[model samples]
Target: MTQQSLVSRRLSSRATRTFALVSVLFVTPFIATSSANAQVYTRAFGYASTEPGAFPTDGVLNDPATEDGALPARLRRTTVALTTTEAPGTIIIDTGNTALYYVLGGGRAIRYGVGVGREGFTWSGVQTISHKAEWPDWHPPAQMIKRQPYLPRFMAGGPGNPLGARAMYLGASEYRIHGTNDPSTIGKFVSSGCIRLTNEDVTDLFNRVNVGTKVVVLPKNGPHIAARELGPAAAEISVRPGLTPARPAVVTQRAGRQAMNIPVSSAQY
Candidate 1:
């Protein structure tokens, strides 16, 4: 070959090699990201049934509110004097007030505004925290998916996941005390049945509590109203008038408190 032809051929070969290198560099990251997502799915849900294309490329499944404009000041987290016979470290969910109290003993508790179950979805009972997880994955229950077919069957946990920063599973039940992506949902009756707190509040609660923590969910129309009527000292009083007053019941001390007769509501996400 002529010298000029040899130079041209050598340049073409170099260009081809550079193009191959660039292709590998670009494609490798995409592949690694996909693999990492798959692994997360497997670890979270114990199965990788859904295809990668089914997930949002941005890693957020829902359109979360950019700001907490709807949140009310009263619903924000604060420490307050609470009068409850229940021991410290217990969680008291006053559904009527849309509030959660982490009993701190000595007439004090850390209170947080929360989103409780909507009208027909309210429940009352005592349950222990069976499990706890951070950035928990979501598998919308069958009933929820039936109601809202547009919801993803499974969503990997992140800022976009409805379960938010942390989750404390209440007993073996589907209900949980968890964080919410939408801060506006706090202090509202929006969930199907689960209790929701702002991500920051939930994270703080999560750090303070642990697995097997006692959770007392007062009825939707229960103690909080009576507390409002009688004062903070009446918080532990059961709403059922005929029943004798007693301490808020725990799993181990059911006989001490009047059993909540409210019907259990349906499970939520």
Candidate 2:
């Protein structure tokens, strides 16, 4: 073979290797970016499924106005002066006033209007958040299904789902602090037992809270210790005039049974 032909062959080989290297350098990041996008999609909206109704394709989820309408003026989320012994991250659900307070410590809290259980389903207790999920699926518990047989057996999380944007499971019970598709229910007594807030408010609270955060649900007719906005000067005011401030009963866990000093009811949503 001629030396010139041999040199030409070497040049061709080098050119081929350079082209392959360039392709890898350009394509690698594209592949990595696609993978990262998939992960983010899953984290934001949960896994995609092939099952029917698993994810509605009707475009309802994209309509933010329907999913989150304007709450009433009094029910809007706001900062308030709160006097409580609970720590900064504690959640206090005041069912009587249909509100939830995220204690910020230093005698203050960020109050969000919430929907509580109906009259017969009202409950009170202390529990710690056990789990957190974004766009969580819902499986109606047996009790709930019996109460409302017309309800779907299961629901995939989305703007249409009753448990909207996020959910924080409370303790071992079925109750959860979750977002709601119906913003009008924010200041009403409508839920089976789960405490619900508007999707916007719940997402804000969800980001601020973490797993294992303490939660105290005040009963419907119980003392409104955490709900009242006693000024810094009158921090020790009682539920009624001339009465001692009542403390919420502490919940105790036992083998197969939970006990509390106050009479408490349990419900699932």
Candidate 3:
């Protein structure tokens, strides 16, 4: 064949190869997306108001603010006096204060900072812990695909599992009190649904509470008030700047020689 003809044929072959590669690259992701949509992720957000959480989806335990906007990782080794009373083994979460209390009894509570559901998710209710687990595996539910189909279908419990160190299943519903890899999220609101705790805190709680323990979650706004009128949780003890991790604790005291002082109180003592 003439050299010119040979050159032309090679160019044609290159063009054909390039076209085939381009076609595959363009079509591959769509096919993959179709398959991904068929899988599950978390049950947190629940159905489209019509669907129930069945698998494939769902943490933070309570905060009124979005986690992204709030500073993370400030609460540590802090305990607050509670006005409400719970059984020694019960778990009480105050959404307004963004704190979770593992009622240690008499007066003191094992207080831990927490992150609640931000915005539309603020809610209040009283329920019991029907069950519990460690390093729990996660299975996404069907409804999740309606939002992000590309999410993983199943994830084992461990460092990577969003479920964290422990899980306390709630009601017949898909809600859970679970751990999170993002400890910074502990004091902020984030997550589609379900209460999230720091991995360390969850592990600590898992070792303490048993099945059938009571769980009380407060609401963000009104009308849908929490089931129990547990009283003011921060009445006796207070933190200022206030509950924000960004704030400093401002403890006030009154009374005689037995008065409480800043960062100190009698209720939890």
lDDT of 3 at 261: 19
How well does model 2 score by local distance difference test?
0.66
Which candidate achieves the best TM-score against the true structure? 2
Could you give candidate 1's per-residue lDDT for residues 149-260 as a string of tens digits? 5446556666556677678988767788987755656777878788998766677688788888999999987658222221332253222221111221111211222111
| Cα RMSD (angstroms) for every candidate in the order listed | 13.9, 15.5, 16.5
> Hey, what RMSD does candidate 2 come out at?
15.5
The local distance difference test score of each candidate is 0.66, 0.66, 0.55
Cα misplacement distance, residue 143 of candidate 2 (Å):
0.8
Clashes of 3: 23
The regions of model 1 sitting more than 4 angstroms off are: 1-70, 225-269
lDDT of 2 at 203: 72
1 versus 3: better lDDT goes to = 1
Candidate 3 C-alpha lDDT tens digits along 1-269: 69999999999999999999999999999877755543322223321111122122222322323322344433442344444556776787777667677775656666666767766655667778778776676654444333656445555555455565578877655567887645555666676456786655565567677787888886655322123223333443433331211111111222122111112111111
lDDT of model 1 at residue 204? 69
Tens-digit lDDT string for candidate 2 (1-269): 69999999999999999999999999999988876765553333222222233333323333334434466655666677888889999999988989898887888787888888876877888999989887776665666546555445556666456677778988878788987655656787777678988666677788788898999999899877544443322232212221111122111122222111112244321
TM-score of candidate 3 versus the correct structure, residues matched by position: 0.55
